[model samples]
Target: MKKLAAGNWKMNGLAAHLSEAEALAGAHAQPGCEVLICPPATLIARMAQTLGDAPIALGGQDCHSADSGAHTGDVSAVMLKDAGASYVILGHSERRTDHKETDAAVRVKTEAAWRSNLTAIVCIGETLAEREDGKTLDVVGTQMKGALPDGCTAENVVVAYEPVWAIGTGKVPTMEQIAEVHDFMRTELTARFGDAAAGIRLLYGGSVKPDNADEIFAVSNVDGALVGGASLKADDFGGIIGALERA
Candidate 1:
């Protein structure tokens, strides 16, 4: 499976910012690993246009559980696919926190995304308190049981671990900590999902900036990263992509 560096530009980007997507697609037309950017929903169509036939894929930050609905301001997975998105991020730490999303909600959304043929990047993580209590693995395992659907496959599912304490806080877990979580995730997924779990990508999401990307990518089971702020700029994200290529 190709390593994936997926960017979640949550609630950011406009028509003027579409140039960064173009710059990324131009610079890394065919990096060794896969490149993806989930720009704000408003920029999806134009960004996809900017990245025509490029290796850099496009994704969405979130999606509604329903295929179609009367919910105002809610974009469904069906809508995201229609808008040219190949993937949709579900249960991001920010969405889980700000929206108070439970694991059951994430699973329904993942099923919806898969129904639309969109790969689901399901996020699972521990809060600062859970980490402090040494329950990170336990928390993540429980989330996997709740968020993942019964018929999931590697082709349609990816898992991202973003410590609530680390995301956008300029903080990062040690390489050992990251390795532990990734390895545990691989084990947990394999236990329930069977052989296909070996192919499922496990991504780390936090303060994944250029300077630390190379080392993070080197960790065992660390297939790639789910980028945040660094992904908003072409240069920074390109730097991370370069590191993954080298890894």
Candidate 2:
């Protein structure tokens, strides 16, 4: 399976930040692995325009479970697709913590993404408490099983493991820790999805910076990275993409 380097801009970025997107497109016009950027909902269309004909793909931070409804302040999967987004992130930790989203909700949203012909980048991970209590595997496993729908394929779904405590904390897990979770996720997916799981891309997210990207990418089952703060800049994100290409 081809690797993927996804950048989640989160709630940041403004009209002026489009210049960063443009520079990123200019710098890596042709990348070895698939490159994606999920900026705020407001910038999707403009970023798409800025990256015209570039190899980069645009995605949305999140989407509503329904195609259309009375969910005010919510962007539906269809809306994201219309906004020039080919991918939509679902069940990010921030969504789970901030909006109290459940795995069941993420599953439906993922289905909604597929209904709109958009790929769903599903996020799952354990909290600091869970990890400290030796429940990391169980937490992540349950979340993974619940968030992914029945028809998930390599073509439509990408899973990202972002430990809640590690995100933006600058405290990364040991390489062994990352490998264990990734390998476990692989085994879980293989058992549940059969052969299709092998082709599914598994990304590591949580304080993923350019300087540490190489060693992280070298870990087993780490197809690529779902970068956070480092993704806000073209230079920083480009370093990560370069590392994945070399991996």
lDDT of 2 by residue, 1-247 (tens): 6899999999999999999888988899889999999999999999988888999999999998888988899999899999899998899999999999999999999999999999999999999999999999999999998999997789999999999999999989999999999999999999999999998999999999989999999999999999989999999999999999999
Candidate 1 CA-lDDT value: 0.92
For all candidates, what are the clash counts?
A: 0, 0
The CA lDDT at 84 in model 2 is 96
Residue-level lDDT of model 1, residues 1-247, one tens digit each, is 8999999998888899988888888898778998889988988988888778988788899999999979999999998999899999999988998999999999999999999999999999998999999899899999999999987777999999999899999999999999999999999888998998989999999999999999999999999999999999999999999999999
**TM agreement with the true structure for every prediction:** 0.98, 0.99
